[model samples]
Target: MRYFKGVLASERRIRCIEAEIERQQSRLALNGVEGGEQVSRTMEGDAMERGFVKLYDFCDALDTELIGYVEEREAARRTLDCLDDGDMVEVVYLRYFEGLRFPAILKLLNAGGRNMSERKMYSLHEQALCRLWRVIPREHRQRKSVQ
Candidate 1:
């Protein structure tokens, strides 16, 4: 469970970093001179270098965290077929892996539920985590084994 949460948090951090890089790239593009090709080339190169650094950091973080997370998650997934519908899995993927917020999830799902607040969303997420826990083998659930 801790591993799952850690994975989710790491993924969210990566997405946030990527979004910042995108915003920076857009700013860099817009700030370039309109007609001077030479000037634009130099600016673009510098911007790309900066963007690369940000992207590299994000990728490194994702790679490091995702390595173990994926292995454990896959192993757990294969153990039990508790997940009947793919929606729960999809929600987990989007919320954790893609770093989407609850409102974004609601919009994406197009499910009408004004009363389905963030608390409910979190509860559902916890349920999913529990399901994953159940799927994982007892030995695998040990702290040292997961690490």
Candidate 2:
């Protein structure tokens, strides 16, 4: 859950950083020529150099964080896919990946015309979490030994 939430938050942060970078890039391009700030005009090349340094640092951090978030999300998705039950997989996927609330997930899952109560959905979610927890990294070692 933490990893999934982090992925969503990281995506938002990444987008904001990218937007800032784009804004800075275009602004820096016309820094001196256009209606740039008085400070920029006074500093000449120094202000522009500082702007480039700030943009470069932001890009580097954004790249590193984005990569880490993507890798974590992929690992969670793969782990979720390992569940034998399709219902469990769907529940977890909708909750974590899609960021749907319980009511929304219940609506989607119960759309097959079956009368699925909220309590039942909650139970299924708990079951899915339990199943997910069972497939830990140490369990992989056990499976290998058994094999």
TM-score top scorer? 2
For residue 16, what is the lDDT in candidate 2?
90
TM-score of 2: 0.69
Per-model TM-score on C-alpha atoms: 0.39, 0.69
* lDDT of every predicted structure (CA atoms): 0.60, 0.75
Q: Candidate 1, which ten residues in sequence have the lowest lDDT sum?
A: 32-41
Cα RMSD (angstroms) for every candidate in the order listed: 8.0, 6.9
Q: Output the lDDT of residue 44, model 2.
A: 67
lDDT per residue (tens digit) for residues 1-147 in model 1: 554455566556656766765675566457662232343346667765665566567667667666766775565445335766465675676675566887898676656544455666666766776777755556446443564
